[model samples]
Target: MPATLNQLGLPAVIVVGAIFIVWFVAGNELMRRRGRSLAIWSKRALDPLGGRQAIQWITLHSFRLEIEGLKPPFTSGNMTGLVESWDVPITWLINRLNGRRDMVLVQLALRQQPIRGIELFRPRSLLAGDARQLAVQEGWTTEPFEEFQLAAMPGATPQRLATELLAAIGPRRADLLRLALRRRGLHLTLALNIPNRQAVQPAELTGLLQGVAAVALRYATPAEATD
Candidate 1:
């Protein structure tokens, strides 16, 4: 190595590492586009690197999260997320960056039909951002829970729905974000925050998705009715 760099030692390494991380995190996504694409880009950057880490056994597991809302031929707006779960160092960095919220694979689904009414549940103070104000403007009431605050449309019952949702989600889980929509029914935002230094079984992730879906569907309207 260069004598100057060698003399700098750890400080030089830190500087070089920071620069490399920024470039890698930005990748082609940021330079090529603007706004949200950069966020998506970060996920993309994680993919191959995390995959490589997995192959080399540097990380426990990796997965690709792709969003395909439209079932038909039209491929208008699709997005993907790449995550390396169970990497202690990466997980710690991510949590610190995301306001200490447990890092997890957040999966969201929005439907067209309004099941009963809006049912929203959020923490007393969200680390992500402020709770959505759209519903509140249109006349939703906020009901406080033991650890979370729920906001539902005027006619909707927040307290009761929260009970049902909690019962469905079970205990010993990570953070959650629940909200309602206009005619869009009860949208869902569920995640699995557990990360460990071991391979994640496919069946395990499958079961988690299934459990989340079960809770979400309770407020979902039939497809025919939605159409």
Candidate 2:
């Protein structure tokens, strides 16, 4: 071994190890705090929907939240949030550099259906490719909507449906990655990083969901009605 390397090795290693330990612990604590805040925020966001039961979990890089017992049209909702990558410095750096902020996968089940199928997506979202492919395979007609891609079951949905749905989303439309009307219910994917842990209002979310449901109901007509 070289004299200079051997001379300082053990002490240097100990110091480096201590720093790593501190970093890991601090990162974990930060994640825990964020998780708690999110849990509270989620409860508030779901309360108006009569969310009677809820479950939450915290992990190294994500938070999972689910709630049930919603009001009419919605039976349940679940959110899968990817927001705590800070526990791993490398991953955190990469995510930030890519302009990839945290996001939530929101799945909502409805008690009824307004239309057979529909999909709206922000074309720049990471999930855009998959949504597009699914639309094609399902034989849905696709069209452009400013910065979004809109698709609907050819004979099952109205041409004005897209306009109404976007209007329902209101000013927050830009943050939406995808809005789908499936056989069972609706799925909304939203980006939650920009406002960085900002508390979401229950009334606001409730309103958004209700507005979309209202539009869906308005378009629930026979296939020939769309023609």
Candidate 3:
């Protein structure tokens, strides 16, 4: 019996190894599909706002996945006019993995517009437990509206300006803003107050934000023309 057991050990190890490989591959693929689907869905949802151009920008600037060691992290960004929001899906995922069922801080951001209000609806299962309670207990408030003055280079349209801004700051947060607005039935443009807020003369804040957006956009989508 001992001799027989020893002989089977190698085959058992091989089977276990095979199973692990399959599982890893499956998990990785699943993560990729989920990320892509999220990006597509987000883009479609925002398509009505500014047409295909808006959709394209949103899709291009949307979600990103970061895996550190064995843990996986997901972040989504969106710009509603000028207000950018970022969703960190990883916190919820991590909490779920640890057996906590509650909506974590899935979205956070710094914006140049006032957050009228925030409401979390139909949170995913991973973010299901005590989200409302947690939000209330923590007294979460969106960042205050900031003012920026950007110089319109030559003939920069509103869309061009928006695109330039997004380029400066990696689109992950901007995409999250888009998702938040959709979920809350809010208008992205109104939230950011783009028209009224764009100052004629450049200021420290606007200059900084625009500069950052310019650099980031160049890095993320270098070939895209800008005004």
Q: How accurate locally, in lDDT, is each candidate?
A: 0.42, 0.67, 0.31
lDDT of 1 by residue, 1-227 (tens): 68877788989789988876776555434323322332333344333212221111112222334443322111112222223222244654664565343233333344433364444445532322334465456566666666666666554355666666666556424434443333442244444333331233334443444454455555556654433
TM-scores, one per candidate: 0.47, 0.71, 0.32
RMSD of each: 10.7, 5.3, 18.5
Candidate 1 vs candidate 2: which has greater TM-score? 2
95, model 3: CA deviation in Å?
11
Clashes of each: 0, 0, 21
Q: State the lDDT at 224 in candidate 2.
A: 37
What is the per-residue lDDT of model 2 for residues 1-227, given as tens digits with 9 covering 90 to 100? Answer: 69889889988999988887787788888867766666666566667878675565657546677777788766777876665456667776776664455566667776655655677887766567878897887788888867778887665344577777788888777567777766544443333332355544646665777787777666554323233
Show model 2 residue runs off by greater than 4 Å: 1-25, 56-61, 97-99, 141-143, 154-159, 185-194, 221-227
Best by lDDT: 2
lDDT of 1 at 116: 47
Candidate 3, which segments miss by more than 4 Å at Cα? 51-124, 129-227
Better of 2 and 3 by lDDT: 2
Against the true structure, whose TM-score is highest? 2
Model 1, position 40, has a per-residue lDDT of 39
Model 2 clash pairs? none
